[model samples]
Target chain A: MTQQHKHIISMLVEDEPGVMTRISGLFARRGFNIDTITVGKTQTPKVSKIVITVKGDDRTVEQIEKQVNKLVDVFKTIEMKDDESVTRELCLVKVSLSNEKAKTDIMHYAQVYKAPIVDITPKSAIIQLVGKPQKNDAFLELMKPYGIKDISRTGTTAIQRGGNGEK
Target chain B: MKGSEAIVKTLIGSGVHTTFGFPGGAVIPLFDEFLRFEGKIKNILVRHEQGAAHAADGYARASGKPGICIATSGPGATNLVTGIMTAYMDSSPIIAFGGQVSMSLIGNDAFQEADMMGITLPITKHSFQIKKANDVVPTILKAFRISAEGRPGPVYIDLPKDCQVGEVTKEAPKKVDIPSFKPVYRGNINQIKKAADMILAAERPVVIAGGGTIIANAAKEVTVLMDTFMIPTATTIMGKGIIPEDHPLAIGQVGMHGRKAANYAVINADLVMAVGCRFSDRITGNTSSYAEKAKVIHIDIDAAEIGKNIEVDVPIVGDSKSVLSDLIVVMNEKLKKKTETEWSKRMKELNQLCRCNMDSKKEPIEPKKLLFELNRILKTDDIVVTGVGQHQMFATHFIDRMKPRTFITSGGAGTMGFGLPAAMGAKVAVPDTNVFDIDGDGSFLMNIQELATLKEENIKVIPVVFNNSYLGMVRQWLEIYYSKRYSQVKLGRHSDFVKIAEAFGLGGIRVEKPAKIQDALKESIRSKETMVLDVYVEPESNILPMLPPGGHLKEAFGGCMNAKGVFF
Candidate 1:
């Protein structure tokens, strides 16, 4: 059987066109499916940081990390499974509140969860919640009894908690 | 100026003529601006934000243009995530503009404030938050370019309320200056040469084409290679119609529920030239055993997909059309056609055997027969879209897509409700062309709400529902491996789809008899508005030629055997 392991990869690269294409293309050529990828600008101008989460064996991930780092625009690439990282996700949920009683009940739950009421209409109220994915999920389950209508969640984003920010 | 006015102007400047959205508190100002610019930019007020997202997706898929959708902060924005993920999976270009809390209150737990950027990061190709109104124009331009460029997917832009209301004294940048965004279009010569050499040396070679080929418009180049080398080609679900199904080199689709001949050829081949395909698990059943004897040469535009699932012996990264062209050039220079008459003969025999096994009875309305009849009625230029599940597999198996863009289905995501809206978009894209959405009863209801959108747009699309009254795919699994637990697969609740269509002010027809299918379809096609033909199918019917999950492609069960061990 093929060995499978979860890998978290971090990269510092020049922010430009087709870089993502090139990076994703490298993974595609190797037949590597990216489980998750988060890209955002760093504090410095013209630089972006990309965190890619992949599920593969250690050897495969090492090979992928090496190939990715060799790309001209990539400044650095590091596998983050060994590093301390802070992962966060955000979610917004709409709860159906047909009457004032349901609305007030939902507000009380929101207060307990520290979720803010974002939008309120006579029929429904939207709540904004941000935390680890598990926390958001727990909050959503708590609200489910109140008649949740819809949910939107961002998968996951990670940053090194406290380490060499630059590679 | 109000934030709403800035958003409207940015949309107009981005060349968005139509937008789908619902209003909320955070976006009330934007809705007000939408009213002011009602004539300039058509704002569609969908019943739900989810519907708005699907409508935008439909518009984008049909028009080959980026579809735009708007939603307020929190729930309204979150509702668009499903649509966003759907677009992302299918590689459709769409722009989702989400309302955000004011910048000052972004992390203060203010009203209508949700972290839109963080929430949509995984599903979106890229996303941004506007800190000032001046950034809106440039951001819109960048978002459009990113969403529509090579291997197009969905992008998002979150507008904070304060930024939309802020002043913009300077003009937005005419163009973005990201140097790292260039996609590699041309194939590397050495890699192309190595691939060509391998193909030339192999006695039995099969080509697995995927959605990337269609996206890259590489069909012509693929045809040249197949014809020159007499290589048998099979397609992924997304790759249907990239080559005419009737072409001699075409061996049909491969993987779970794929054609037996196609799977056999892949397993027996000395070399597998996988072009523009990701080798999704649906196509490769058992990862360790798949193509065990073959040298796998995987070529794709997206480098990340190359060895993620299946390892490759030789990898080439570039646009499918360009890479195939270069490979062809090298092959023409260094190689001669190597004939494998015995292998070809065996393949033909297997194909015949599989077809014979799948051939169903003429009476009591066979699903395959329906597909054949639909194929017979369709013009070569007509477009066909399918909802996910058994019906989707059946359509991909039987339909003859002779032209490019003739077959449109949600392949990657396999989103259930994608058929109707996508068909609507296809019709809107090619107004003169006929488009049909072949759907399952279970899948159809997921987006049946879009029936109203079709009526409002006045777009004509023929919807043929295979009313099996169950989730046929799941039911098939339960029957084969799960002891027929049934679970929630049965559609016990009554839903008169015909009546539902009528409720939406569209044409409706119900076909109980096999003989009525043609007439019902013809009438629906002739109708000017959206039409639904709810055809009752066999309740216990299962899609045949099944390769059980994790089973070798070669180990296919011909069909469901009766109690007497007789194949259906």
Candidate 2:
């Protein structure tokens, strides 16, 4: 039986044309299905930090990391696991509340989950939550009985919990 | 002018209305400008940059328009690679734009500083990196032109963050000039005459069409020639729908899983006209022995493709549509009827012989029956996409494509998830067209995440999975050659595909009974959302009429009836 585990990978690459095509081609051809990926600029100019979250076995992760590093633009690749890293995901949940009583009940539930009411209307309210995927999932599950209308989630973004600068 | 504004104008001028992308810091300026263009352009914000790339590919295949995708620097840019390669392999026109680091820090290993150009050189048709803001417009225009013209494929343009923020004169180049970018459009007249004479004089002549016909839009011209000459035609998997399958001259696909008559005819032909096809190993079993008795006349847009695999007696490098048109005209002028009624009768007899062998009652399920049922239930205009491997060959062999643009599958790259996403793209392109993805269980799971996208888009496609619980084609190879060690071939745990479909908020049905396939397919087609028909086929069942790899095409195995009348 193949064991499934999640890994967080961070890559530093040269900003150039068709870089994405090369990276994604490697994954697709190699048959590695990526779960989530987040990209943003770093503090240094011309450099960007890419956070990729993938669910696969240890061998698959190792192969992906090695192959990704072989790309011309890639400078480095670091894999972060749950125990070794800090991760967070943002979620916006729009819930339907027919009356004042339901809105009050929903707000009460949100407060217990540490979610903030970002926006409120007569018929519904949008609650903002930020935490690990599991935490967000649990909160969403708890609020499911309250008639959830829609949910938009930003896939996991992570950084090393304690900076050791191993690289 | 901001780099984003220039990019938008270039796309609009190039006739692009839709784009898929995910924005990041380096690309914020472009996305901001995108908002200002609002109604002029439509952007689909995908969950991931990779998804955006695939979505653009989907859009392009369906619309026959160049699909555009954008991504920020580093990871965002890297994510688009797979989709670009997918487009490249399938000859789908696409333009991908990525954010890059500023020119000053380009080689300094600055944040997100990765050499995208070098990485994508082998895969992309063309790639450009903008050093100056003024170059963006011309670069984009060139990329578009290169992507859409002749043997369409993916092109890329990288814009530095500083360039996006810089000012430039609003002058867009009216034309692009490239010295080495000429594509041949007309066939050589002498070669055309020689091929025509051979076809008219030969006792048996067969035409093998490939994806190049679709790329050249030469289906009509090909049909005209076939009908005029009363010649039989066969297609590669990518060549499906190039010739209407119901046409009397059509012989279905030719390959390992090709029809018995098509394979037999190819071996027996006196002259073979191969048009716009690369003659992949799958099509030509053994390069040296393929069409050993026949004189081959090969016409293709890419000169490199000719004589690369199989040597040709007559080679013409030009566009398929134009070459075929010239051939038709020449044939009409120079040719007289050379009737091969005897040869036709013999071929028909062999076809009948092959048909009888497939009717064995000992097998638990007949693949041909499944295909027949699917063909019966599917609409004439509905699109069918398949994953690569045995199932793909089976679908090509059995399914009759009656219309153009009704079959979408990966022929070059042979990517697995291609079926589901390509079908989605086809459905999105023609909302009214019923699209179905015929896949195997091993292939279906590759990009099953698209189920979420399908659900979100409310796009319905019927996914008929040939669930034999093994990598059917590879297992066939191992069984035939490697003594069937069965290393990682069997899917040990039965996948609850129906349950998985339900989890994705789509309808699902498990077909254990073969009789209910037609009804299940009909219902799935009529449904409002995506549906998965998990079919439980026999694990050890192999596609018959197998041509051993690296062996002569004529020396095909299986599809033979023993003395007891049992098909082996």
Candidate 3:
């Protein structure tokens, strides 16, 4: 039997119109579900990096990687292994300041997690959190008791740990 | 120069002698330029845009050049979707051009405007929309390059009406630069060496080839490798003619309706070397039980296809022709030729068993018997194209294609209307070669309008229709799986096909009896004009040696269905 696990796939693609659609369309067409995806320009002006996370058996994930690599716009596709890469996700959470005790508890949790309070109003406070997706998930869970109002997240993005940064 | 003239000049400059297209409002400027440069390119006007697309696909499959098809935007471009998908699935090279409305009115959904690039993106290798007159030459040239290179497929170009009418000064580029689209042609030396060693060690080895063999022109290389090692071979329908069916080691095609010997060979082989073939589900029914004993070595030009369908022990990514050449060299260096083995003897016995009732003399002609007659009549190099149905399977069973590109069909897409126009396109590509479309009543009617195109173009080809009066393949499945609870599969015989052919200004022959099939075929071939032979065949007959849907290879059934509705 094969085991299913999360796979972080990164690609260097041409910075052209519809490149994102081409990438996402391929995943949809091939029936590979994307758990989360993030894209941004690389150091090279003409190149963009796309990071996608999908959960599948190793074989299916490998097939997805090969299929994505076949697109003409893609230059390279690599699996960003958890051990050899640093993955980060930025999330913003808005929490309701229900009471003095609730606000103090929320501030204590934010400090412990190193999440800075970016905005504070009379009734609500917006905290910015940057960490691994799982750590952010834990942070969201802690803020739930403080009456979480809304949330925004930039999905997981990754780079290799050392000097070679996805050439 | 006008952009229309630039487009025409680029086509001529790219060594395109013929193109299939239909004129409409958006493409008037482009159509006018065909008259301006009269003798340089032959523009064959087709009845429908779908016909244009299929004709182009057929031409590409036959001539190994990228087939060109042009259509106006909106409905015309949308009509081409099926044919483009057919070419896309089979990896046949075709360049499809759709004339859009003016650039300014693109987003407004102007009359006769369509998003050709957006529509064709999933089906084509690449697509481009020319933004201005100056971009026409370069984009068209790039489309041609992309279509024919690597694993060849359709490439679509959206030509706005303004771009076609506007003036252009730019010259055609000397070379196209696509930095991210390089295709690997040569296999890794280490992998090639490993494959050769594996072949040498195995006692029961089978080579399964597919459409990529024909696309790469690697039939000779494949044949040489199998012959040198005394290996029996089977082919997918797409790879039908890659190996001459008459060869001693050939076990015939392997699939749902494949030969028993071929399926048996694949199931029992200790080593399976799949060359230029994607293991489609039809080829490997019930994947868990398919070739469970075989150590598979898959070779294909596309890395994505290597393990897309089936797992492999060794995967070599390279063009079939190049990889096979290297494998042949490496194998010959360290090995001595082995004579006929026990496996070959068993293959011969199985083949003989499979041929028991193929020559049956029945009243309403047996499907296999009709093909047996066709097998006797057709020349080795004569091209035979078939639409999807019972007749196509019968052709696959009995057609003895001795050359590459001789047996063309919509293998992946299974498009019903592909035969007639595709045959016409093959004839256009190789005018001297005799081309024939072996079709069914159901499949023939789907593209019957192409008969007008045939009459107009004066393209000489023969069409043999097995008039079963029903969607025979679907009806057979209904009978088998649904306990004979038939549905809308019956296409009642209401119209006279022979009269229909005559109405199109072509000679028509009707063959009702088994004995008349030969003379009807002979007369059609002897006649210089296009002829249609409407051969009325056994209506209730089902294709045999069929593996029940999702059934294992070892469980495939042959012979007739019994009174209890079970195949014996």
Candidate 4:
């Protein structure tokens, strides 16, 4: 049987207009679904680091790498194994407070998860959390009772573990 | 200097002399620039954007350059989707331009606005949206380079009205600086040696030449290898004219509707050397058993296609000519002469045994006889373009295309209405050569209005419509797959192509019997002005040696009987 597993891929791409569209379009056209994605400025101003998590069989993953490399703006691509990578996701949620008891409960959950309450009001409270994707999901699920107004989650960004693991 | 001027200058810089386009509001400034440098670059004004796209594709395929086309926003840009996809599927290098809505009105649903860059992203090798006038020259140079570089395909540039009209003080750039794109051209010496070793050892070997052989201009290299090793070959639809089909060792096409000898040669072979060919499902029926007996040697420029479909024993990722040239050099020293003498003799015997009888004397005219005469009447260099159907398969089967870029067809997309316009485009590219569109009755009606373009432009192209009164290919499927219940396949004798051609102020003729087929073809050829011969043929005759659905090439069917000795 073929092995289907989640792969963490990173790329240094040209920070130009339509670069995102070109990269995303390649995956979409080939039917590779992106589980999570994050884009950020790299050490070099003109290059951006794009981290993408996707699920595919071994052959499909290999083809995905080749297809992604075919794009002109993409400089280099590195595949990071799930066990040998540093991964994190950040989420911010604005929840409505019905009473003082609700604020106390929200703070208790935040402390347990090492999340910080960024803002507070008589009718609402804003809490910020950072962890793995599953941790953020747990925080959001626990915040449901406090009447969550809105939630914003940054997709997981991954990096190779340890020194000299760069490609 | 205006941005549009920069764009035109870049076109001239890239050695482009001809382009096809239709002007609209968004591209007015670019059109003005085209007119300003009118003599330097020739732009053919087409009736529709799709025509421009297809004509440019034909010109590109004929002349070995990236074909160019321009269209306006919204409907104009959308209309080119078919042509763009056709080029994409067949791996043709075509540089297309779409005039987008201004930067301010990109997503505001402004008049004549369309997301061309987004729509064409999947179809193009690279797509760029020009935000600044200064970037026009660089973008165009990149577009030209990217389109023709590795695994050649269409590239698009979405030039907004604002960018076209914007002014740039600096001159157009001379060199492109896209650091990320580098195409691999040379094959590894070790892999070359391994392939040469296999070629030297194999007793029964057949070579499968594909479209990439033509794109890489590697016909001479392939021919050298064939002559030196005595390997018989079969081609796909797009690879028809890569090498002369009349060569003694050629077994014609392979796969569905392919020559029976070609399929037999491959299925019975011990080694299959596929050069620059993607073993698509259309070519390799039942991928699991496509080449079960052969240890495959696959050479292509695209690494993605190496083992994408059929499994390969040796996968070499490089240009076709380079790899084949390297193989030839190594084989000369590593191998003995006349290695495939017995295999080659058997190939010839099988070819003669399975050759379809094309000399039928039946009434209402058989397709094989007509295609054979058409093949005999045309010049070796005269180009043949085709739309999709049984006629397409017949043309590929019978016509002996002796020159590269002489047989143009929509092989990948199987698009109808590609024949006439593509013929006109080829004629425009090479004025001295005669162009013929071997079109089917159903495929001909899709863009018959292009007859007006032919008459107005005085383009000397012959439209030989094989009027079988049905969608012959689809009807064949219905006959084989279903119980002969052909729905929507018959076109119940309503439209008169001869009268339609005359209405467009062109010459026309109708041939109903077998006796008139040759004379009708000759008459169309002799007349200088554009003409059409509405030749009616037998509706039941199907292309021979067709692979049944979900079957291997060994189990291919011919004349209602399976080549594997089974009758269905």
How should the candidates be ordered by lDDT, best one leading? 3, 4, 1, 2
Error of 4 at B203 (Å): 2.9
Model 1 gets an lDDT of: 0.80
| Tens-digit lDDT string for candidate 2 (A84-115) | 88899999999988877788888898998889
Tens digits of per-residue lDDT, candidate 2, B495-557, equal: 878999999889898886667778888888879999999877777878877888777776667
TM-score of each: 0.78, 0.73, 0.97, 0.92
All candidates: CA RMSD (Å): 13.8, 21.9, 2.3, 3.0
**Residue range with the least summed lDDT across 10 consecutive positions in model 4 chain B:** B559-568
Candidate 3 docking category? medium
lDDT of residue B253 for candidate 4: 88
The top-ranked prediction according to TM-score is 3
* Candidate 4 lDDT for residue B4: 90
What's the lDDT for all of these models? 0.80, 0.78, 0.89, 0.85
Q: Candidate 3 — which residues are off by over 4 angstroms?
A: B559-568
Q: Write the per-residue lDDT of candidate 1 for residues B147-207, one digit (tens) a residue.
A: 8876678988898877777777666677785454566778788989889889888888889
DockQ of 4: 0.67
Worst lDDT window (10 residues) for model 3 chain B? Answer: B559-568
Off by over 4 Å in 1: A1-10, A13-58, A62-167, B1-15, B31-40, B335-341, B356-364, B559-568
